[model samples]
Every structure is written in C-alpha cells, then in structure tokens.
Target: FPRRRRRQAQAPLSPAMATPRRVPTILFASSVAAEQDETFVHSLGLNGLLELIAADASFAPYEQTLFAESALQYSRRMQTAEQNGKLDRRVEGFLNLLSAHFLSQAAQKALEYLLRHFRVHRHNSASLLRCILPYHGTRAFVRVAQLLRGSEQRGAWLRDGAGRLTAPPPRELVVGRAAKDTELLGQLTYLGAAHRVAASFSAVALLEIASRMRFTDAEAPLLRSLLEHAREGIASETAPDRRLVGMMLIT
Candidate 1:
C-alpha cells in the first residue's frame, strides 16, 4: 500500500513584512522624491535608522528627514493595521526585533562601510555637505575646510583688489580654483548646524584647523563666530572627563 504524502505547513509572514517595500530615500525642496529608491532601507526601522544616520555621517538632513518621515509613517500605518485587525499581532514584535538587529554593533559597522564606499556626483557634494552639517557639525566643518584648502592649493584664489578695482565679471565665474573656493566658502558660511557642533571641539583643534585653511579676509567673521561659539559650548558643558580630554588635546 502506498503511504499518503505528508502535508506541509507554510510559515506565516509577520504584519510588518506585509507593509509597502518601496520608500523614497530623499525629500527635496520641492517635496519631490529622489530618483533613487531605497526599497530595503525600511527594514532598518525608525530608531534603527536614526542611529545609523547619526553614526554614518553621510546622509544629508533632507535625506535623513525623508527617511525619518517615511519610517514614522510606515510605523503608524502598521499600528493602524494592527488596531484594525488587518495584520497579525506579530507585526509589533517584528518591528521591535528589527530595531534590535539594526542597533547592534555589527549593523553599525555595516553602515560605516556603506558611508566610506558611497559616492555622490561632484555637483551634489556641496548640497550633501550642507545637509550633513547640522547633524554632524564638527566633522562637516573640517570637511568643508578641507575642500576650501584643496581648492586654494589648486589656484582657486581671487585677487583681493581685482573685483574692487574693476567692474565684476559679466556672470559669476565657474572656471578655476577661485570659483571652487568661492563656492565652498559660501557653503561653509551658510552651514546651519555649525553653532550646535562647535562646542564638541577642543579650542586647540578648532584653532589649528581654522588656521590651516585658506579662508579669505571676507570669511574671517564666519570663522571667528564659529570659534567663539565653540569655546562657549565647551565652557557651558560640564563633563569633567571630556573636559580633561579637551585639555589633553589642547596640550
């Protein structure tokens, strides 16, 4: 007699897994979705993503905001579904688990790796720098300084008297290192989060980095403001341990 085939049971999908997979990675000034779709980024969850971006230091503010909004909306939708009984009770558990997994040290390492290898178009770098400045202020400051320095080394200098001595060029020049320096200086001056992150620096580090950069006379005020803000920040925060570290850095 032939034995009857054994029946197999399929594992059920968690409710979170049933949510929409596609999410816009970046939100622009026009509220348009970026061409790049981060379909799998949602698996990281909201707080998990916040941790990742905080550590990664590459996602601009708009992108970070977009990720945050998208994650929040998705989570809300899931909560609603659970309330409505459209999804299994396991969805909440899955979300909690996802957050746990992404917050692990291993997940942080993966994010760092992605940051190091990720490349954006040259034209986009300035905008990216602008976005990251508020979230990772001191690091972004150093980065912009480095860009200015590199541009200076590449001969992007404007003759101090040339513009004052004669009429300005017909159009904004975008030809050489001077143009690059000008653009970078403008970016550095306008960075939104500079004051917030200024205090993280030891006074010495701030001075040293500032002196090393080729900021023009016109940019002095911005540099001075950042330095002053940083000093004030260091003074107001009373972390004795870090204060000791700052002294060590100073020495």
Candidate 2:
C-alpha cells in the first residue's frame, strides 16, 4: 500500500510559463541618457559619429545635430589660429580630416564656414583648396574665388600658392600641357575655377597665372575679361616684373 501511494504529477511547462522568464526592463533611464551626453558623443570622434549615422538609417535624425556640434567644436579649435599668426599642424590636420570626410554639399558648406569664421593662412588655405579642387571642380573653385577676392591676406596666400594650385585645372589642359606650353595656346577653354580666382585676385602671383593664360576660341571672352583685370592690376601693382607681366599680356 505504501509503494502504491500516488506521486503528485509535476505540472508540464507551457511555452508562456517556461522557467520564469526574465521580465525585460530598462534598469535606469538616467544612466541611458547620460550615455548620450554631448561629452560622451564627442568622445566618439567626428569620424565615428558620421560613420554610425551614414551606416544606419535609424540614426538619421541625429545627422544634422551631430554635424552642427562638430562644426562648433571645430570653430573653437580654429579660433586660436585665427587670432594668432599661423595654423599649426594640428589644426591643419583637423581641417584635412574634415575635408576628407565631408566631400559633398556638406563639404562646400564647411569650406564656406572656414572662410567666414577662421583666418585661413597659406598652408590651411592650400589644404582647403586641395580638398575642393579635385572633387568639386569649377563650382568649388568659384566659391573659393569669391571668398578670396577681397581679403588681402587670402589674396597673398593665393599668389604664393599659385604653383601648387596648378594641379586642378581641367583634365584636357593637364594632358595637353596647354597651360605649360611656351605660347600657352591649347586647352584654354578647359580652364577650371582656380583660374578665375587668379583673375579676380590682383597680386604679383597673378602674373604667374596670367602668364599661363592661353587664348582660345571657346575662352576668348574669358581671356578678354582677364586681360582687362590684369591690366588694371598691373597699374596698381608695385615692383611688377615686366617679364612675367609681359608673358601674361602676350596672349
């Protein structure tokens, strides 16, 4: 009779009641919010944040906010160089990184922001020019030209950096060496926006660019305009080397 005592049957585990399920909960909302603080976000680095937003559509809402904050932080870094004489390598590297990451419309905006807020020295301006020239082409050049037109410091930078600026003229001109030839006659029509900047800016360096200006059927009007500006600039320019000026006037 003792052996026959019925054992209580164990309740079968149902799917809903399986092994006391862990009730999912946000342990601390404040802790989660703290993780998203600006300091914390900035620590992620500009590249990291941009990559996260770019890679995940879910993060799209934060794109503009992140970019604005990044720019503000960048502005603080640039302020010192703006007040001081030169931009050190650290600032230059940061600008280069910024240009490298944002190469689209965003890049154009950033470039404009730089022109507006910061004092662009020769090195920094060259870095920016290099960034914009290859990718954005004439439009970008025009924007830079507009910014550099009136500023004496920037104009000087352009003049000094003219040789370095030669890289971005059009493909045809580069291939033909038209701008490099003795007469400077071929590939005239293919001149990019950088040439326009040279024309707008009246500096001794303009002579270097002016000398390379070739007359062509397509670019005849442009040549005429440049000639007018060059002639005007030559009048005001002290110690203008006639040799360089003469070459510019030849065409």
Candidate 3:
C-alpha cells in the first residue's frame, strides 16, 4: 500500500482583514467624476483663479472681472497659510507674498479703470498727483502725464453765469503746481539706489506728477527709464521676493 499522503494546511486570514473596508467610496466617486469636467472643476492656476475671484462683485466692483477667480484663489491661499502649522515663518512669508501680488494687481486695475471711466477734475487730479509724487516709475508717470495732458487739452476755462462764453481761469485757479516737484526726483533717486527695487508705485506717482504738471513727451522718457530699471531689478530677484517688491512698489 502507498504511504498515506500528508494534507497541506492553509493559513488563516489576519484580524485586520476580517473588518469591513473603511473608505468612503461615495466621496471618492464624486471627486473622480468632478475631475472629468474642466469647467466644473476649479483650477489652481493664477490667471484662471484670478478671473473667478474678480467675477465676484465684491473684489472688483468697479472694474471688469478680468481675473476674478485668481483673486479668490489667492485669498483662499492666504487662509491656508494661516492654518498651516509646519513653520510660523513660512506662514508670514506666504501671507506677505499673496498680499503683495494681489494688491499690486488691484492697484493697476484701479488705475486703469479710473483712466477709462472718471474724468480727473482739478481737485481730484491734484490728490492723485500727490499720491504718485513719491513714487516715480514710468507707468505711473506716463498715466499722470496723460491726465495732465488731458487737463491742458481742456484748457483752463470757466463757464459764464448764462453758460454762453467761457474764458481761461487765472493761475491761482489751477489745482496742482504747474511743474514737477524737485523733492520727488530726489526721492526717486534715493529709492533707485537699492539693489533689489521695484518702481510700480514710483511709476504711477511719476505719471500722476507728470500729468498734473502737464509734462511733455520729451520729459517722460526719463520717468520711463526709471520704471524700466525698477522692473528689471524686480525680475532679477527670487520668486517670492519679486512678488513682495512688486506689491510694495505699486502700493
């Protein structure tokens, strides 16, 4: 007779396997489906998110929502920074980065909007020039020059009581000084001395001053040079620092 065959024994399952699978299958299924639709899903890209954020009336009530979603996403990123616990310094740095980026964009948009919709009156134009005077970069100065040019184009005329004929006002009637302030140029020179500098605000300021002073095209090239230099410096810096400087330069 043949020797008795030995029976092989199977190993039992582990205790861990005995329990039901704990994943929330429904949640994962929804996420997968949502990802399939590009329009339905929110993108993290800067431009896309800015468009979404700007679409909301709150962020850009006066101007077109060119990058609303991106603005909203930036705000959310700020919140995330607040919640992050890994490094306290990282949180502050991230917050600064976000603030700088958004604020600069906002200021630019606001300036553009004003240029399109609002007429710069003598008083308001003076105030605007004051704001721009300390900051002497090309973009700002160019816009200022445009405003000043507009004023000059309109001429210094006043309507009569019957609104028939008008005559130019006396020199004292003008809102701002006729020429660019010497102090502003000095300040620009000082700021330009810095190695890592941005001049968005300076540009805006220069534009405003030029506009108020009614600077000729011949005079604007100097302001434009400052703006170009500032932009170059900003571009040369590290990514986060660039954002910070851009914001500071504009604001």
Candidate 4:
C-alpha cells in the first residue's frame, strides 16, 4: 500500500474563537430573595397576610425560620396599629400565629423574638403571654416562666443574667389584669420556673400549677394525696384565647 502523507495538525484555537466557551454564571446573595410563584406573591401585603393568618397557621420544624419572619412582620404591623389607635383583627391573628410557632423547632426563637417587643407594648406583650399560656401546654409555660424569672439555664437562648428581656414581664397582659390578678400571675410564673427545674419543682410547686385559674362548678379533686395538701387559690373566671390571643384581648 502506498504511504499517504498525514494531514497537517490543526493549530489550537485562539481564545477569541475558542469554540465560544461558555462562561460560568455566578449568583451573588441578595437581601431580597428571588421572586417565587404567584401563590407566594399573593401571600404578601396586608390583605395577603391577613388571609394567611385568618386561620391558625402552623409550621413544621424546618419551616420555623420562615415562621419567625412572618411572626415578626405581624408584630410590627400590630405595633403600627397600636400606635394608630386601631387595635384590629390583625393583632389577634398575630397571636394565633405565634402560638402555633411555639410547638415548632423555633419555640425558643419565637419567645426570644416575642420578648423583643416587651419594651414597646408591655400590656399587649403580657396579653400575648396570657393568651398562649393556656393553650400551648408545658412547653409554653416553661419558656414564659423562664423569661418571666429570667431563666439562664443551659439551652436557654436570648437570656442574660439580669433576665432583662428585649421587652417586659408576664402580667397585666390579657383581659386587662386588675390588681386582683397579680397573685395569680406570680403563682403561674413560679409554677413555670419550677417545671423547668424538676428538682426545683417539688410537690408544692405541682400544687401551685394546679391552682385553677377558673372556678369550675364541678367538685375539685381531693386526696391532694389522700386529702392531705389541699389545692388552694382556684379562681372562678373564664378559659381563654394570641402572637399576643387573637385581638380578643385588645384593651
């Protein structure tokens, strides 16, 4: 076979003509998030916010961060309303939303964020606590108690040694607490702290928590361990309702 001369090798392409290389696109972080779908868009603005909050909004553990932002926004709106002298339905919605977040992973963060408003609208903040205290159970009680007493135990976030919160304390909140209600609030606060520390929460502390806020027509349970320690201070009132109970507590 006749040997054929090999074709000359092609020279490497220059950068200008280098097969039009694709440039890598880099995305920089921005304070504003990229826009999402219309559903998301519809979920913004005062009306949208109210629509979402009209119902009890609950978030999963993973969605707690988003929950925190939403709750904060609602709180700010309430502050604006309070300033304007218009305590409206929006306020109540915020409370309901806040209560739902308590059960989320952001419970601690939610409380911390809540305490942030203590200084601004203290009465409302207290109302906020009063509303959530009844419905959220032990987790809520322990946190509010810790904040009230300024618990700085391990894992207690947003807490300092002084117990000075970003906001105020836990009484005179819901229902326009009268001077009569002071003792009950104190008892509740202690009960909550005791629960946080099992050693601190003795049989005596348990009895205090059992102190009924509302008086029931039904007979009280006896045998305080076979009729020994009697549960006292059961007040006859009402059962309730907030980031703060939904504006139902608005004074």
lDDT tens readout by residue for model 4, 137-224: 3544544544332122311322346743333223223112211344333433322322223212222333343442233433133212
Per-residue lDDT of candidate 2, residues 1-251 (tens digit): 55787889999989665654222111213334333544533333444545644644443444454334654455444467554433345445444444334445434443333443343433355454434433434544534533342233332232224423432255343223333332222122112222333222222333444555555676565466556544544563443443244346544
Model 4 stretches with alpha carbons more than 4 Å out = 1-92, 106-108, 117-123, 135-140, 148-251
Q: How much RMSD separates candidate 3 from the native structure?
A: 26.1
Off by over 4 Å in 3: 1-103, 121-123, 149-251
**Could you tell me the lDDT of residue 133 within candidate 3?**
36
Alpha-carbon shift of residue 77 in model 3 (angstroms): 43
Q: Estimate, for each residue in 56-87, the C-alpha lDDT of model 1 and write its tens digit.
A: 54432423443344433433334564443422
Give the local distance difference test score of model 1.
Answer: 0.35
> Which candidate number would show the highest TM-score if scored against the true structure?
2
Per-residue lDDT of model 3, residues 24-88, tens digit only: 11112334433333222223223333552464433333123322344323332355644333323
Per-model TM-score versus the true fold: 0.27, 0.30, 0.23, 0.28
Candidate 3, residue 161: the lDDT equals 55
Candidate 4 or 2, higher TM-score: 2
RMSD in angstroms, all models? 19.2, 20.1, 26.1, 18.7
Counted clashes in each candidate structure: 2, 0, 33, 17
Ranking by TM-score: 2, 4, 1, 3
